[model samples]
Target: MRLFIAEKPSLGRAIAEVLPKPLKKGEGFVTAANGDTVSWCIGHLLELQAPEAYNPAFKKWSHEHLPIIPEKWLLTPKRNTSKQLGVLRSLVKQASSLVHAGDPDREGQLLVDELINFLGVKGDKKAAVQRCLINDLNPAAVSQAVANLRRNQDFIPLSTSALARSRADWLYGINLTRAYTLQGQQVGYKGVLSVGRVQTPVLGLVVRRDLAIAAFVSHPFYEVWAQLATATGERFKAKWQPSAACQPYLDEQGRNLSRALADNVARRISGQTGTVSRLQREHKKQSAALPYSLSTLQIDASKAFGLSAQQTLDICQELYEKYQLITYPRSDCRFLPTEHHSQAATVVAAIEHNLGQLNGQAIATLPLNLQQKSRAWNDTKVSAHHAIIPTLKRHSGLSKAQGQVYGLVSRNYLIQFMAPYEFASTEVEVSIAAGSFIAKAIEPKVEGWKQLFPKRSAKAGDPAEDADQLLPNLTKGQLLSSLQADLLEKATSAPKPYSDATLLAAMTGIGAHVSDPAVRKILKDTDGLGTEATRAGIIELLFKRGFLLRQGKSIVATDTGRIFITALPDVATTPDMTAQWEAQLTAIAEGRGQYQALMDPLTEQLQAMTLASRSVVPTQLKGLGTAKVFGKKKRARKKTSA
Candidate 1:
C-alpha cells in the first residue's frame, strides 16, 4: 500500500481527487481506487513536549535552573488528535511506499517529516519518503506536482531549518517566560509573562510606536502660498519655493519649516506682480504595480476595505480553496514566475468571463494587457509561491469579501498588459522681488491601469494642500495681474498610530530598522519576525495574550504589554534579534547552515541572557504588583540550627 500524508484535510482530499477514481472514504483517511491511501494531519498532530516531560524537577519554576536546554528533543501526540495520529501510524505500518504531501513551505514539510521520524523513533525503519509540493489544488497543477515528486530526504535541510526555528523558539520562550514569570511573581505580579521569538518582537514594535506617539510634541510651522492668474485670466495656486540659502526656515532636507520666515515672505509677495521665471514641462510614464504579495494585499485590504490582516487572509484562503478563483494566498513574493506568463492569457479570459457575469460594464471591459514583461515577472524574484492572482478556474457565487479581494488580484494582473499611465507635467516658477513660488500641474495622457480604478474627484486620494490642480500655458516672461499671497500655518504632526495596513508594511521590510549594515542586508533578504503564512496569526496571538488592544483600526500596546517589554531582557525586546535569527533560518533553508549552527548560538545566548537576567533587579509592576520578595533572599541561617 502507498500512503500519502497531507498537512491539512483539504489538501488531502484535493490530492485524492486527482489520483484515481472510485476512492473509498474512511474515518480519517481516503483509500484511492489504486489501493493508495491519502490521509491528512489537522495541522500538527503533535506538539513540543513541555518542560515537565524532560524531568519532573524542571517542571517547577525556579531561579536555580535559569536556562532550560533539553539535551534530547521530545514530542507528544496532541490531545484530541490521537485518533487521526493512530490512523497514520496504522497506515505507516502497512505501507510499502510513502509520500509526504505536505504544504510547499518549511512548516508543512516539517510536520509530516517529523511525524514519520517520530513513528520510527522506536527503531522502525520505514520506506523511502517522497515529497509532493502542490502549490495549487487544480488538477493540472496537482498532477504535475505529484509526477515531479522529489525524494523526501532532499528537503531535510528545509525540515532542519524548521526544527531549528521551533527549538530555538522553545529555548527562548520556555526559558525566558519561566524566568520572567518567576521574577514578576517575586515582584508580586501574577501572570505568565509569556514570550516568543516572533511575538515578543511584534509586541516590541507596537510598544515602541505607542511610546513614540506618546512622546511626540507637535511643532507649529508655516509655508507661504499664492494664487496667480495668467494674462489670459487662467488661475493656479503656487507655493513659496525655498532657496538653498533659506535659513532657519529650511530643514536639514531643505524643506520649508519656519513660520516667521514664511510670514515675512508672504507679506513681501502680497500685491506684487510676478513673472514666470521657469516653465519646465516633461512627459512621464508610470507602469502598473505588481500583483499582491500577502503583505501588499493585506495593506490594500486594510486601507481600501478596512479589513484586518487576519480577515483578509481568511477571505483569500476561501477564494483560493473554496471558489478556486485565486492561487495560493500566503505568498511572500510579489513577482510571478517568468514561466507563468504562458498561463496569463487563460487566467485573463477566466477573469473576464467571471467579471462579465458580475459587473460586465466595469470589470469585463478590461483589455487583455498581459503581454508586457515587467520586473514583476522575474523567475529569480519568485519565492516559494508566486504572487496571488486569478486562476484559470473562474466560478462565481463567492462571498462579498471574496469578491473584493479577487477583484484586487484580477485588476493587478490585468493591468500588467495595459499601457503605462502617461502624463505631461508642467512646473511654473514665479519670481517676485522677495521670493519665488512654484505651481505644478499634471495632464493625463493615458489612464492605463488607472482607467479601471478611476478617480472620483479632483482631490481623490490626495491631501488638499498637495492636491493636483490644472495649470494654464504661460511663457517665462509672462506676468500675472491678480497676485495674492497667504501664510498657511501647519503643525509638524506626531507619528500616526499603526493601522493594520501600516503594521503589515513595517513587518514585511522590518530589516530596514537595523543599524548594522551587514545584518540589515541579511534581514532584507528575508521576512522579519514571522513567515508571511504566520504573521497574521502572530498579531492575533498578541491580542489574545493581552499585549495589544485595537483602537478603531489602529493597534496599540496595552499597559501589560509595555510593562512586559520593560521587565523582559533585551533578548526579548527588539525586532533585530528576531531578524538575525531569521537570517540563520534562511541560511539553513539554502543549505548553507545546519541545525546545530542555530541551536549552539541560540543556547549560548539563552544561557548568558538568563544568568544576566538573574542578577538584575526586576522593575516593580506597581498597582499590578504587591510588595514581595524582589531579590534573591538575604536571610542569615540561625547558628543553633546546625
Candidate 2:
C-alpha cells in the first residue's frame, strides 16, 4: 500500500479527496479504494529535543553549562501530538511505498522529513520516499500537485538548511538566555532575561528608534513659495529651489535654516515678472501592485484595518485552510507563476461569487481584461509557493476580519488582469529675481486598475501632491507675473514611533537599515529577520516577554526592553548577524555550503559570547518595576439570575 503523510489534517483531507472514490475514514487516516492510505501530522509531530534531554546536568541553568552545543541532534515527539506520531509510525511500517506531502517551504520540508526519520522509515524506504508540495487546498490544485510529486531526497538540502537554522537558534538562544538570565539573577532581577536570534534584534529596533525620538531636537526651518499666475489668470504655488550660493544658509538636509535668507528670497520674488525656465510633460503609467506576500498583507492590514501582524496572519490562515479562498498564507514571493495566469477568469468569477451581490457588482463592473499580463506574472519570481491569491473556490459567511483580508487578496489578484493607471505629469520651473521655483501637476488619463481602489492614498513620493492644483499650459520663456511670495516656517519633526505596519515593513526590508552595502544586499536577497511564516510570531514573542508595549497605534520598547537591549552587546542587538547567518543558510539550502561550515563558526562564536556574558553585570535591569505578564484574559461570566 502507498501511504501519504501530509503536513496537517486539513491538507491530508485535501489529498484524500482527490484520490479514488469510496474513501474509508479511520481514527487518524483515510483509505482509498486502491489500498492507498493517507495520514497527516498535526503541524509538527516532533520538535528538537531540549538541552536537558541531552544530559540531566544541563537542566540547571548555570554559567558552567554555558555553551551546551549538542554533538548529536535528537528529536522527541511533542506531547500534544504524540498519539498522531504513533499512528503514523504504525502506518509507515505497513506501507509498501510512502509519499511525503508538506508545505513547500524550508520549515514544512523539515517537519514531515523529521517525522519520517524519527519513525524509523530507513535506508531504501526513506530513499524511495516521494514529496508532494501542496500550496492550495482546492481539489484541482491538490490533484495537480499530487501528479507532480518528486523524489523527497531532492529536498534534503532544504531540510538541512531548516535543521541548521533550528539548531543555530537553539544554541544561540539557549546559551545566551541561560548566561544572561544568570547575569540578571546576580543583580537581583527575578525575570527571565531571554535572548533570541530574531527577537532581540527586533526589540533593539524599537528601543533604538525610541531613543532616537527622545533625543531629537526640534528646530524651525523656513521655506519660500512663489505664488505665480499665467496670462490666463490661472495661479499655482511653486516651492523655491535654493541655489548653490545659498548653501551657507541651508542645513544639511537642504532646508533653509536662516529665516533671513528665506525672507530675502520671498521679498525679491513677490510681484516680479518671472520667465518660465523649463516646462516638461511626461506620460506615466503605474501598474497595479503585485499580489500579497504575507508580510505585505500584514503591513497593509495593519494600516487599513488596525490589525496586528499576528492577527493578519491568523486571518489569512483561516482564509487559506478553513474557507479555501486563498492559495497560501505564508508565501514570501509576491509574483505568481505564469501558468496560473490561465486561471484568471475562474478565480475572478469565484471572487465575485464570494463577494456577494452588493460588493460583487463593483468587481463585476471592473474592466478586467482577462488577458492583460502584469509584471506580477513571472515564472522565475515564483518561489516555493506563489503569491497569496484568491483560489477558484468560493465561500460566504466569513467573519468581518476574514472578509476584509479576503477582499484584499481578491482585489490584488483581480488588478493583475486590469490595465495600468495612466496619467500626465507636468513640471514647471520659473526664474524670478535669481531664485528658481518649481511646480508639478498630475492629471489622470485613465483610471484603469486604479478604479478598483478609489482614491487610495499613495504611500510615498511628494506628501503635498494632494494640495497641488493643475498648472496652466505654458511654453519655455513665457512671461508670468509672480502674484505673491509666501514665507512658511516649519519645524523638523522627530521620527515616528514604530507602528504595526512600519515595524513589519522594517522586518521585511531590514536591508535599508544596514550601513554596509554588501551586507545590505545580502539581507535584501535573503529577505530579512525571519521568514514570512515566523515574523509575526517573533514580534508577538517580544511583547509577551515584556520587551515591547503598545501605546495607541505606536509600538515602543518597554523599560525592561530598553534595559535589556542596553545590557546586551551590539552584535546581539543588531540585524547584521542575521544577514550573515541567512547568507550561509541560503547557501546550505542550495547545496553550496555545508552544515559544518555554518555551525562551526557559530559554535565558536557562542562560546566566546557565553564566556563574555559571565563577567557582564546586568545593572540596567535593576529598579525596573515587575515585568508585565501577558496571557489570555478570562471571559467574564454572565451574571447568574438570583
Candidate 3:
C-alpha cells in the first residue's frame, strides 16, 4: 500500500479529497479507493527527551549539574499523542511506499521526518520516501502539490538546520533558566527565573526603554516663523532656517537653543520685503504597500483593532485552516509566486462574493484591473509560502473579528491591481536679511488605491506638516512682503512608551537598535529577533512569565522583568548573539554549514555562561516577590459510551 503522512488532520483530509473515490475512514487515517492511505500527526508526535532521560541525577537542578550536556540526543513519544504515533507506526509497517506530506517550512519538515525516523523507516524504505510541500489547502493547489512530489532526501539540510536550532534552544533555555532560578532562590525569591535565547533579549529591550524614559530630561527649543504674502495676495508661514553664523548658538541637533538669537531673527524678518530665491515643484508616485507577511499583519491588526499579536495569528489560522478563506498564515514572505498571477481574477471574485452586502457597496463595482501586475509578483522573493491572500472559496457568516482581518487581507490584495497614488509637491525658499525661510505643500493628483482607505486623523508632530496644504503659485525672484513674525517655544518630548503596534514594529526592525554594523546587517537580512511563526508566541510568553505588562495600549516591563534583565549579563540581554545564531542557521539550511560547527562553539559559551551565572549576586534578585504560576487549562473529557 502507498501511504501519505501529513502534518495535521486537516491537511490529510485535504489530500484525501483529491485522491480516488470510495474513501474508508479509520480512527486516525483515511484510505482512498486506490489503496492509498493518509495518516496525520497532531503537531509533533515526538519531542526531545528531558534531561532526566539522559541521566537520573540530571533531574535534580543543582549547581553541580549546571551545564548538563547530553552526549547523544534522544527523542521520546509525546504523552498526548502517543496513540497517534502507534497508529502511524502500524501504517508505516504495512505500507510499501511512503509520501512525506508536511508544511513547507523548517519546523514542518522536521516534525514528520523525525516521526518517520523514530518509526524505524530506514535503508531502502527511507531512501524512497517522497516529499510533498503544501502551502495552500485548496483542493486545486493540493492536487498540484501531490503530482509534483520530490525526493525527501533533498531536504536533509533543512531538517538538519531545524534539529540544530531545536537543540540549541533546549540547551540555552534549559541551562540558563535553571541557573537563574537557582540564583533567584538563593536571594529569597520564590519563583522560577526563566530565560530564553529570544525572550531575554526582548525583555531587555523593554526594560532599557523604561529606564531611558524615566531618566530623560525635557529641554526648551526656539523657532522663528515669518508670515509672508505672495504678489497674488496669498498668505503663508515659513520657519526661519538658521545660517552658518548661528552655529555657536545651536544645539547638537541643530535646534536653536538661544532665545536671544531667535528673537533677533524674528525681528529682522518682520515688515521686510524678500525675494523668492528658489521655487521647486515635482510630481511623485507611490505604489501601495505589498501584501501582508505574518509580522506585518500582526502589526497592522494591533494598530487597527487593538488585537494582540497572538490573537491575530489565531484568527489568521482559522481563516486559513477552518474557513479556507486564505492561504498559509505563518509566511514571512510578502511577495506572491508569479504563477499566482493567473488566479487573481478568481481570488477577486471569491473576495467579492464573501464581502457582498458586508460592506455597503458592491465590491465588483470597484475598478479592479485584473491584468495590472504589481511588483509584488516575484518568484525569487517568495519563501516557503506566498503572501497571506484570499483563496477562491467564498463563504459568509464570519465573526466580526474574522471579517475585520479578512477585509484587511482582501483589500491589500485588491489594491495591487490598482494604479499608484500620485501627488505634486511644491517648495519655496524666501531670502530676507541673512535668514532663509522655507514653506512646502503637497497636492493630490490621483487618489488611486489610496481612495480605498479611510482618511487618517492628523497626529501630533506629524512630519508631513504640509501634506494637506496647497501653496500659491510663485516664481523665482518675485518680491513678497513679510506680514508678521513670531517666535515659537517648544519643549523636546520624551520617547513614548511602546504600544502593541510599535512594539511589533520594533521587533521586526530591531536592527536599527543595534550599534554593531555587521550584526545589524545580519538581523536586517534575517528579519529581526524571531521567526514569524514564533514571534507572537515569544511576546505572549514574556507576558505570561510576568516580564511584561500592558498599561492601556502600551506594553511595559514589570518590576520583576526589569530586575531580571538588569541582573543578566550583557551577552544574555543583547540581540547580537541571537542574530549570529540565525545567520548560521540559515547557512545550515542552505547546505553551507554543519550542525557541529554551530553547536561546538555554543557548548563552550554555555559552559562559561553557566559558571559565571553562579556568581550572580543574590541581592540583585531581591524584592522580586513570589512569581505567578501559569499552566495550560485542561479540556473537559468527553464521556465515552459503555
Candidate 4:
C-alpha cells in the first residue's frame, strides 16, 4: 500500500479530492482506488526533545547548571500529537511506498524528513520515499505535483537547511534562556528572560528606536511663503528662499533673527517674477509592482488597511488554509516566471467572478504595457511554492477581513500583468533678479496598473497634490508678477515611531536613510532580519516577553527590554549577525558552505558568552527570606552538643 503524508489536514483533504479515490475517511486520511492510504500531519507532529530529556538531573532548574547544552539532539513526538504520530508510524510500518506531500517549503521538507528518519525508513532497505512538490493545493496542481514526484535525495539540501535553522534556534534559545533565567533568579527576579536568534535582534531594534525618541530634542523652524498671481490673475502659493538650508536657519534658537529674516526674504521676493531659467522634460514609464510575497502583502495591508502584521498574516493563512482561494501564505518570492503567466488569466477570471464588484470587465480594463520580469519573479527562485497568487478556487464564504486581503492579493496579481503607467514631466526654471527658481508639473498619458487602486490616496509623506498636473502654456524667460507673501513657523520633528508597516520594512533592513543601490539590493535579498514566516512571530514574542509594548500603532520598548539590550554585546543587537549566518546557510544550501563553518563560530561565541556571564558577580538580592550560613563542622558539632 502507498501512504501519502500531507503538511496539513486541509491540504490533504484537497489533494484527496483529486486522487483516484476508492473511499474517503474522516480528518485528513483517505484510501485510493489502488488501496493507497493517505494522511496528513497537523504542521509538525514531532519536535526537538526538551532540555530535561537530555539528562534527568537537568529536569530541575538550578543555578549550578548555568547553560544546558545537549551533546546529541533528539526528536520526540509532541504530547498532544502522539496519536497522530502513532497512526503515521503504523502506516509507515505497513506501506510498500510512501509519498511525502508536505508543504513545498523548507519547513515542510524538514518535517517529513524528520518523521522518516525517526521511523527508521531509509536507503534501499525500506519503502520508496517520493516527494510531492505542489505550489497550489487545488486538484490540478496536486495531480501535477504527484505525477512529477521527485526522489527524496533531490531535496536533501532543503531538508538540511531546515534542520540547520531548527538546530541553531535550539542552541541559541535553550542556552541563552537558561543562562538568563538563572541570572534573573539569582537577582531575585521571577520571570523568564527569553532570547532567540531573531527575536533578540528585533527587540533590540525597538529598544534602540525608543531610546532615540526619548533622547530627541525638538527645535523650531520657519518658512516664508507668498501668494503669487499669474498673468491671468489666478492665485497660487510660492515659498521664498526655496533653498534646503532655509528651514534650518530658524531652528537654531534664534527666533528674533528667524522672524527678521523671514520678513526680509518675503519682502525681497514679493514682486519678483519667478523666471524659468532651465527647462527639463522627460517621459517615463512605471510598471506595476511584482505580485505579493508574504512580507510585501503584510506591509501593504498594514499601510493601506491599518492592519497589524499578525492580523495580515492571520488573514492570509485563513484565505490559504480555510477558504482555499490563495497559494501558500509564507512565500518570500514575489514574481512568477514566464511559464506561470499563462495560468494567470484563469486565476484572475476565477477571482473576478467570485468577488462581487470586480468582474471580467475590470480585469480586461487593466493596462497592457506592464509585465512581470523582476529578479524576484523566477521559476527556479521558487522552492516549495511560487509567489502568493489567487487560486483556481472561486472566492466564497469569506469574512470581511478575508475579502479585503483577498482583494489586495487578487488585484496585485492582475495588475502585474498590465502595462506600466506612462507620464510626461515638465520642469520650468525661471531666473529673476539674478536668482533662479523652478516649477515642475506632470501629465499622465496613461493610468496603467494604478487604476487597480483608483481610490487609494498617495502614501504618507508624499505631496498632497497629484504629481501629474497640466501646466498652462508658458515659455522659459517669460515672467509674471506676485501679490502677497508670508512667513510660516515649523518645528523640527523627531523620527516617527515604528508602525507595523514601517517596522516590517525596517526588519527587512530597508532603512529610511540607506540610499546606496547595492546596499539596498543586499538588504532586500537577505530580507533584512528574519523570514516573513518568522518576523511577525518574533515581534509577538517580544511583546509576550514584556520586551515591547504597543502604544497605539507604535512599538515601545519596556525599561527591562532596554536594559537587556544595553547589557548585551554589540553583535547581539545588530542584523549583521543574522545576515552573516544567512549567507553561510545559503552557501551550505548550494554546497559551497559547510555546516561546520557556521555552527563552529556560533558554538565558540556561545561558549565565550557563557563564560563571560559566569565570571560576572551577580547583583545582590534584596527582600528575600534571610538565612544564616555556618561551616559544616560547626553545624554538626552544635547539633551533636544540643
Candidate 5:
C-alpha cells in the first residue's frame, strides 16, 4: 500500500475528501480505493533532542558545560506528538510507496523529510517517494497537486537548506541560551536569559535606534517662508532662493537680519514681470502594487489599519487556516505564474459573489494581466505558496477587522492586473523680487487602481497634486498688475519617531540609506532581513523577552534590552550578519556551496562568541523593589567620626 504524509491534520482531511471513492478513514490513516494509506503529521512530530536528552549529567544547567557541541545531532519524537508519529511509523512499515504532501515551503519540506529520516526510510529500497504541491486546500487544487506529484529527489536541496537552517538555529539557541542563563544564575539572577539568531538581531535594531535617540543633540535651525499672491488673486507660499546656501544668514550667531535682508531683495524687481524660466512636464503611469506576501501584508496593515505586525499575521493565519478563504498566507513571492491564472480567476469570481453590491463593480472590472511580470514577482521564487490571494470560496461571517484585512488582500490582487494610473504633470516657474520660485501642479487622467481605495485629503505641500495638472492660461512673460506677499519663519524639525509601519520597513532593510542600485535590488529580491512567516514572530519574541516595549504605534527599547545589546559583541547585533548567512545559504541551495562548509565556520563562531561572553559581566539593577543587583555590591559605609 502507498503511504501519503501530509503536513498537518486539517490539510490531510481536505485531501482525503477529494480522493476517489472507497476511501476509508482509520486511526491515523485513510485508505484510498487503490489501497493507498494516507496519514499526516502535526506540523513537526519530531525535533532535534536537547543537550540534556543526550546525557543525564547535562540536565542541570551550568557554565562548565559552556558550549555543548554535539558531534552528531540526534532526532527524537516530540513527547506531545509521539502518538501521531507512532501511527505514521506503523503505516510506513506496511506501505510499498510514499507520497509527501507537506506544505510547499522549506520548513514544510523539512518536516516530512525529518520524519522519513527518523523512521529509517532510505533510498529506492524505501517506498517510492513523491511530493504533492498544493497552494490552496480546495478540492480542485488538491486533485491537481496529487495528479502532478514530483519525485522526492527534486526537493532534496530545498529540504537540505531547511535542515541546515534548523540545525544552525538549534545549535545557536540551545548553546547560547544555556550559557547565558547559567552565567546569569551564577551572578545571582533568577530570570531566564535567552538568545536566538533572528531574535538577537531584531533586538539589536531597537536598541540601536534607542541609542541614536538618546545621543541626539537637537540643533536649532530656521527657514524663511513668504506668502505671495498671483495676478489672479490666488495666494501661495514661496521660500527664499538658495535655500541651503542661505542657512548662514538665518541661523549664524543667532543674529537677526530680517529687515536688512528683506529690504535688499525687495528693491531688485518689485515690478518686473516674473518669467517662466522652466516649463517641464511629463505624463507618467504607475502600475498597481503586487499582491500581498505575508511581510507586505503586515506592512500595509500596520500602515493603513494601525495593527501591529503580530496582530496582522495572526489575522492572516486565521483567514488562511480556519476560514479557508485565502491561500497559505506566509509567503514572500508576489506573482502567480501563467499556470495559476485560471485558478486566480476563480478566486476573483468568488470574491465578487461575496462582496455583493459593496465592491462588486470594482471586482467585476478586474483585468487579467498575467503576461506582464515584474522582477519582484515570479513563479520560480515562490516557495510555500503563490502570494496570499483570495480562495475560490466565498467568504462570510467575518469580524470587522477580518473584513478590513480581507479587503486589503483582495483589492491588492485585483489591482495588480488593472491598468496603471495615468497622469499629466505641469510645472510653472516664476521670478519675483525675493527670488525665482517654482509652482507645480498635476492632473490625474485615470484613477485606475487608486479607485480601489477611498480618497484621502491631500496634506499641505504634498507632491501628489503634481500628478494631475491643468494650468490656467499664462505666457512666458505675463505681467502682474498687483501683488501681495507675507513672510513667515519656520524651524527645522528633528527626525520623526518610528511607527509600526516605518519600523517594519526599517527592519526589512529597505531604508533610504541603501543607495546602491545592486544592493537595493538584492534586498528587494530577498525580502529583507527575515522571511514573512518569521518576521512577526521575531518581533513578538523581542517583546516577550523584555527587549522592546510598544508605546501605542511606536516601539521603544527597554533598559535591559539596551544593556544586553551593549554587553554582546558587535557581531551579534547587525542585519549584515543575517544578510551574510543568507548569501551562503542561497549559494548552498543553488549547489555552489557546501552545507558543512557553511555550518562549520558558523559553529566555530558561535563557540567563540559563547567563550567571549563568559568573560563579560552582566549589568545590575539597583534601588528597585525586588529587582536586586545580580552581582555582589559594596555595602554602605557606617557613619565615620568627624
Candidate 6:
C-alpha cells in the first residue's frame, strides 16, 4: 500500500474526495479505492521531551541541577494524539512507499518527518518516499500537485532546520527558565518565572516601553497657525515655517520648544494679508496594497474587530480549516505565486458566489477585475505559502467572526485586481508677514481601488492624502484679504505603550531595536523573533504565564514580567541573540549550515548563564517583583494629611 499523510484530518478528507475514488474509512486513517492509504495527524503527534524526561532527579526543581542539557534528545507521544500516532505507525509498517502530504512550510515538514523517524520506516529512496506540496486545498490544485510529486528526501534539510530550532528553544528555555526561577524562589519570591527564546525578548520590549513612558517628562511648546480666507470667501489654513535660526526654541529634531517665540510670530502674522508665492499641482497615484500575510491580517483584524492577535489567528484558523474558505492561514508570505495567478479568476468567482449566497452587500457595488495583475503576483518573491486569500472552494454557514475574517482576506485579495487610485494634489506657498505658510489639498479623481474601502474625508490642513481637500479656485500670485493667526500650546509625549497590533509589528521588525548592525541585518532578512504561525501562540503563552496583562487594546508588561526581564542577561533578553539564531536556522534549512555549529555554543552559553545565577538573590533583584519580594509596597492614603 502507498501511504499518504496529511497535517490534519479535514485536509486528508479533502484530498480523498478530490480523487473521485471511494475511500475505505478506518479508525484513524482512510483507504482509497486504489488500495492506497491516507492518514492524518492532529498537528504534531510528538513533542520534545521535557527536562524531567531525561532523568528522574531533574523532575524536582532545584538550583543543584541547574542548566540541565539533554545528552540525547527524545520525543514522547502527545497524550491525546497517541491513537493517531499508533494508527499511522501501524500503516507505515505495512506500506512499502510513503507520501508526505503535509503543509508546505517547515513546521509541516517537521511534523511528518519526525513521525517518519519515530515510525522507523525507511523513506530514503525515490520510490519509497514522496512529497505532496500544494497551497490551495481545492480539488483541482490538489490533484495537479499530487500528480507531480518530489522525493521526500529533498525536504530533509527543512526538517533538520525545524529540529534545530526546536532543540535550541528547549536548550535555552528549559535551562535558563529554571535558572532564574530557582534564583527567584530562593529569595522568597512565590511566583514562577517563565521565559523562552522569543517570548523573553518580546517581554523585554514591553518592559522597555513602560520604562520609557514612565520616565517621560512633559515639556510645553507652541505651534503657530494662520487661518485665512481667499478672495471668493473660501477659507484655508497654513502654518508659519520655522527656520534654522529658531534653534534656541527648538529641539534636536527641530521641533519648536518656545511659547514666546511662537506667540511673537503669531502676533506679527495676525490679520496680515499674504500672497500666494507658489502654486503647484500634481497627480498622485496609490497602487493597490499587497494581500494579507498573517501579521498584516492580525493587524487589520485587531483594528477592525478589536480582536487580539491570538483571537484573530484562532478565527482565521477556523475559517481555513473548518470552513475551507481561505488558503493556509499560517502563511507569512504576502506575495502570490505568479504561476498560480491563472487561478485568480476561479477564486474571484468563488468569492462572488459566496457573497451572493450570503447577500454580502459590503462589496456588491464593487466590480472585481479578474484580468488586472497587480504587483502582488511575482514568480520569485513567493515563499513556502502564498498570501491568505479566498480559495476556489465556497463554504456556507460560516460564523460571524469567521465571516468578518474571511471578508478581510477576500477584500484584500480582491483589491489587487483593481486599478491604482489616482488623485491630483495642490500645494501653495503663502507669503505671510512673519514667515511663509503652506496650504495643501488633495482631490481624488479616480476611486479605482479605493472603492473597496469606505471613503474617508480628510480634515482641512490635515497632511493625510485621503483626507478631504476642499480647495478654492486659486492661482499663483493670488491675493488673500483677511488673515488670522494664533499660537497653540502642546507638549511632546513619550512613545505610546505597545498595543497588540504594535507589539506584533515590533516582533516582526525588531531589527530596529537591536544595536548590532550585523545582527540587525540578519533579522531584516530572517523573520523576527517567532515565526508568523507561532507569534500568536507566543503572545497567548505570555498571558497564561501572567507575564503580560491586557489593558484595553494595549499589551502591558506585568510587575512580574518587568522583573523577569531585568533578571535575565542582555544576551538573552535582547533580540540580537534570537535574530542571529533565526538567521542560522534559515541557513540550516537551506543546507548551508550545521545544527551542532549553533547548538553546541548555545548549550555552553545556557550552562554558563545558569552557573552565574548562583550569586543571584531574588529579593535583592533591582527589577523583578521587588515591591512584593521586599514587602515595601504600600497603597496611597485616601485623604492627604499635611
**Model 4 segments more than 4 A misplaced:** 24-28, 62-66, 125-128, 225-264, 358-381, 454-470, 510-522, 614-642
- TM-scores for all candidates: the values are 0.90, 0.95, 0.96, 0.86, 0.86, 0.91
> Candidate 3: lDDT over CA atoms?
0.86
**Taking the tens digit of each residue's C-alpha lDDT, what string does model 3 give over 1-642?**
999999889899999999999999999999999999999998878878889999899888997897889898999987888899999999999999999998888888998899999999999999999999888889999999999999999999999988898899889988999998989988887678888888899888888899999999989989887788986789877878988989998888899989998888888889999889999999999998899998999898888899998899989989988988999888888999899999998999899888863235467777778999999999998866788898988898999899989988988898999889999988889998868998888788998888778766655673324355567888899999997787888888788888777888888898988999999999988868878888888887788778899999989999889888888999999899999988899999989999998899999999999999999975756766565443443321111000
Instruction: Estimate, for each residue in 1-642, the C-alpha lDDT of model 6 and write its tens digit.
Output: 888899899889877776647878889888888888889888888888877888899999887887788888899988878989989989888887888988888889988888888887652533368899877777777788779898888888898998898888877877777788778877766656756888888889999999999999988877777787887788877767787778777887666888788888888888778888988999999998899999999988887788888889889777777777888888889998887688888887778777652223445456667778898998688866898889888767777777778888888888898788999899888888748787788888888877777656545553422245477888898888546686777778899989888889899998999888999899999988798878887877777667889888888988878877777788778898888899899999999999998998987887788898777665754334433432442221111000
lDDT of 2 by residue, 241-280 (tens): 9999999988889999999989898888888999999999
* Local error of candidate 2 at residue 349 (angstroms): 1.1
**What is the alpha-carbon RMSD of candidate 4 to the true structure?**
8.4
Relative to the true structure, candidate 5 reaches a TM of 0.86
> For residues 498-527, could you state the per-residue lDDT of candidate 5 as single tens digits?
666777777676423245565556665555
- Give the runs in model 1 whose Cα sits over 4 Å from its true position: 121-128, 251-257, 273-279, 352-361, 370-375, 454-466, 475-482, 615-642
lDDT of 4: 0.70
Error of 4 at 232 (Å): 4.8
Greater lDDT among 4 and 6 belongs to 6
Candidate 6, superposed: residue stretches over 4 Å from native: 123-127, 229-233, 273-278, 356-364, 457-467, 473-482, 620-642
> lDDT of candidate 2 vs native?
0.86
lDDT by residue (470-515, candidate 4, tens digit) is 5666666656675555666666667788889988988876433245
Off by over 4 Å in 5: 125-127, 186-188, 224-273, 357-384, 431-436, 460-488, 510-525, 621-642
Write down the worst ten-residue block by lDDT for model 4: 633-642
> What does each candidate score in C-alpha RMSD?
7.0, 4.8, 3.8, 8.4, 7.7, 6.6
Lowest-scoring 10 consecutive residues by lDDT in candidate 1?
633-642
What stretches of model 3 exceed 4 Å from their correct place?
A: 357-361, 459-466, 618-620, 623-642
